[model samples]
Target: MSEPLLSIHDFSVTYDVDPPVHAVKGVTLELARGEILGLAGESGCGKTTLAYGVQRLLKAPAVITNGSVMFHDASGEDVDINALGAEEMRRFRWDKISMVFQGAMNSLNPVAQIGSQLEDVFEVHRPEMTPRQRRSEVADLLELVRVGAQRARSFPHELSGGMRQRVMIAMALALRPQLMVMDEPTTALDVLVQREIIRQISQLRHEFGFSVIFITHDLPLLLEITDRIAIMREGEIVEVGRAEQIWTDPQDAYTRTLLSSFPRLTGERGVVVR
Candidate 1:
């Protein structure tokens, strides 16, 4: 097998409370370089928690109780992300790994123009770039996501939801990170917009050669776009397999349940149930 771009071993996270909720439990998985790995489960199954935990984006009360997240970068350097200090971690984020957060359309700065927000990513990360260069780069990023460059002058509210979503994606791709952690990127959009977002993500992944850790509750979409799928339930990864294998020959009962949850329009219904 190829060297994994990222590897998680026995990872666990817990929310500290009167009765602590174990959010993620001993989940182990691997994401290969330039591959799309989907984390599929029903809502509150710890899918988002796992993604946040791996990226070290968890807030207080959500403690990572165990395990290691090892990231192998293109430079042939292998580092345990858990070991990085705050400054190093800050530098690591966005430049090496970026996230397109869930409900990203809402995440954009409502007060800022799209150009200013996109330019901020470079201003922070690529501070050495001249002002003209930053503007050029921001325009390119907007175009990369298929949003018109003129839309850069528009406020977040001025753009449609789909356009705002595309803007979020463009911002995430600004630094050309080696891996992207996208948490339910298509959530709350219409079916056609969702499909378009998925198509753009897949296209960009292929064109840019970056691996993706795609987190979503939809198994059907995962099967369509990801190379591999990991099914999570109650904070645990109950199944991990090739996308096709998970669809055709699921080993775990929970996997089958998630598969059956999305009904096919044409296929015989009973066939999937059995």
Candidate 2:
């Protein structure tokens, strides 16, 4: 495998309450440069928590109790993400790593134009760029995600669910970060649209040379898109292996169960026999 872009070791997160809830427990995973790593598990299995913890986006009441997140920069510098200060982390995000949040399509500002929202990324991260340059970049980003530049003027509600999802993807790609953490990006979209989004993501990853941590509960979907699959259960990774190996022969009972939970359609195409 190529050099690891991100190395996470002994990571844990907890919600401090009357009795602390250990949301994530000692996760140790690595993402190879330019490779897609799928994190699969049932809902509430700490998949999202791990993503948020890695990015340092967890808020009050939730704390990183242990572990280290090491980001290997392209420049050959190793960054200890857990050690970054507030200002440093603020700048680190969107530049080194970006997140295409779960249901992010629905999270877009309803009143804001798509172009404006896209430009906002540049405004914060690339402030030195001229207004004209930002506008041009925004248009380019939209096109990169297969969303027409003309739709940049449309509000979030004006676009279809798929289009809005594409817009979110465009935003995530705006900075061309080395890594992207996508949490259930295809949720709520129809199967066709979901497939399209997945295809776009794979193509974009190839073209942009960025690594992706694709988090989802769909083991079958992960098998199709990811190079490696890590199965998480109750705040821990139960198994990790090549996608094909995981599908053909999962060592962990939990992984096998997950794969079996999704029914497969066999026999004639376009014909459903109940």
Candidate 3:
């Protein structure tokens, strides 16, 4: 197999506080080119924290105790991302790697139009593009994410939650990043809308050709989309394997129990009733 595009080795993060919360504990994972790896876990289990750790985007009081996140660039440079300076990281954030935050519907500016918000991504990362080029790029991005170009003129509040999420995906794709991190990309929406967004995300990945780290707590949904799944608990990974394999034969007790909790309709072993 080709070398993974991103590798997190022995990564751990601890927050500096009175009790010193340990968010992630020695977690290691990899994402190869065009691969989709889902990080599934309950809240407080460190999935989001680990995403922040990989990009070195953790805020103050969050300390990386040990280990490193290495990004293997297309040019064959293995960049130790943990050591990247803020300026380099700023450059890397969009062009090299992009992240789609949970509740990205709320992330868009209330005052700004969707086109302007998408333009902001292009502005920050591709500042040299002419105004015409920027508009073309923004329009194209909106189309790519399955949002009508007309919606670009609308505000985030004017659109539905799913549309806003698609806009976020469009913004994340503006740079054609090699890796995209999605944390709970489809939470809080009704079932139909969530399914629509997830389907769109999968289709867009096929169209754009980028690796994705899709994080969510929903096991049934994650199983449908991701190639591989990493099951986490208590700040550590309990299992990591292909979706079908884990669904059929989870070796870890915790993983099996979690599977039991999410019984799929077109079911197999994991979804089997007691």
Candidate 4:
């Protein structure tokens, strides 16, 4: 195992609505170097909230009420992300940690070419690089994510959903971040394409050595790709265990319901469809 990279110590979140809703409730988790930790829960269960909060992306209405999210830098310093100011977080956001968000395709500039948009990352974080160097790195990133280098010149509108997602993955990896937060990475992708992306990401994690926080709703899919899983419900993590162990022996009723929900193509559920 590699060094401990990030720690979320008993984190909880609350929304400051008319009647405040607690989203994340005392959730404690950690990720080691090169590890993949999956956050599994249904919609509105705060999986994405936790991921975005770790990256300091929460808005005004939503507030982190308790706990600390510490980022262990490559220099061996522990930086508390929640305590940082706006400018400080700007320095850390994409350079040390990155996110491949659910709406990442639309996050790209509609008017800009894909490679030029990717160059913005380099421009902000790696300003020393010339335009030529930035373009070279963008091409390399495309290849790293198993996409053709030529697609870099095209705008986001020209690409399919899978292709756009692949571009987002490439952009996330461009900085060679030590940790990445991915929420429903293959959300709009076909099952086959989703599998391909998952396989590539797992391979890249092995090759490049970055810890991943994977958020998704598919248990069978998560079972196939993740190292560990934190099964969550109504804003709480009920069980945590190794992926294989959880798949075989889930400790929570919510976890069991989720496991049973997977449509096994050859099982009883399949009989109805076939």
Each candidate's clash count: 0, 0, 0, 0
Q: lDDT of all predictions, in order shown?
A: 0.91, 0.93, 0.88, 0.88
- What would the TM-scores of all predictions be? 0.96, 0.96, 0.94, 0.95
Predictions: Cα RMSD each: 2.1, 2.5, 2.4, 1.8
Error of 3 at 130 (Å): 1.0
Rank candidates by lDDT, best first: 2, 1, 3, 4
lDDT of 2 by residue, 1-274 (tens): 8799999999999999979889899999989999999999998899999999999999979999999999999999999999999999999998999999998999999999999999999999998999999999998998888889888899999999999999999998898899999999997899999999999999998898999999998888899899999999999999999999999989999998887777675634533346
The runs of at least 3 residues in candidate 4 whose Cα sits more than 4 Å from the true structure, single-residue gaps closed, are 268-274
Regions of model 3 farther than 4 Å from truth: 263-274
lDDT, model 3, position 148: 85
Cα error, candidate 2, residue 31 (Å): 0.8
Write one digit per residue (lDDT tens) for candidate 4, span 1-274. 4588998999999998989989999988888888899899999999988888778799979999998999888888999998899888998898889999997877888788888888899999999999999999998988887778888879888988788888899888989999989998888788899888888998899888998989999888788888889998878889988999998888898899998887785667552455
Between prediction 2 and prediction 3, which has the larger TM-score?
A: 2
Clashing pairs in 2: none
Tens digits of lDDT, candidate 3, 1-274: 4568998999999998989999999998888888999999999999999998898889889999988899999898999998889899989987889999988888899999999888887787888988789999999888887788888799888988888888998988889899999998888789999888888878877887789999999998888899999999988999999999988898999998887887557757644446
Query: Which prediction has more favorable lDDT, 2 or 4?
Result: 2
